[model samples]
Target: MKLEKELIFPKGFTVRKVIELVTANERFASKIYFQTKSHQCNGKSMLGLMSFMLMTTIGESYIISVEGEDAEKVIQFWNKFVREIHENTTLSYWEEEGAQTVQEAMCQSISFWNSSVRSVAQSYLKPGKKEI
Candidate 1:
């Protein structure tokens, strides 16, 4: 599977936000990855994104490509993720650090992401199973 979209982060967005987005797609057990002219990172790993120096800024054109078994669902998640960021620029979902430690952040991240995309990924799920 494959798809490409030009996305813009509202403003003040960071690699951490990328981490969250990447984390969301990672849940699908798919072999997803992202790339640009200079960087390519595994969509399923936060470290993969950071280590590749994948970062976003307002108005920058990010040509993102996603592929894998659940690529379509992940792309939908990314679309929803970016739109929500624009709508809530003042309170970017990745914020609200209810997480105090690394482990806590990991747990909270999974929690935040699950809450964000359960609906979009649901179509790929078996009836009543709630996950993709």
Candidate 2:
């Protein structure tokens, strides 16, 4: 199967992202997908995709080749799957710091803020004995 058309993606979806997604997600790892293969598309099996080890560098592209009566349908499904992931936002690993360290954390944060303010003020100061 050879991809008759090109599938372009943005910089964020580079080879690193492919590897990260595949490794982190069991579903993706199990899917029959290939980054590179003799056919445009590889077998829709996770193991098959793992074997391809696609060079997902910037501007790298792959052809998805399929045949038979279901070729179009399979292509659509593949495209849709990729599209969904592309549009989704990655969840943040760190949310709020939480109240576990509120006391010491608050003090440290305040100190940091004070230091930042002092540093910024120093840049704008005239020859003076520091403005409080």
- Can you write out model 1's per-residue Cα lDDT over 1-132, one digit (the tens) per residue? 777766653453466687687667768755666666566777677787666443533455556676667778877887777777677667435343321232343434455656546455444344543233
Residue pair clashes in candidate 1? none
Poorest stretch of ten by lDDT in candidate 1: 94-103
Off by over 4 Å in 1: 12-19, 51-54, 91-132
Q: How accurate is candidate 2 locally (lDDT)?
A: 0.46
Error of 2 at 104 (Å): 38
For every candidate in turn, the CA RMSD to the true structure comes to 16.5, 14.0
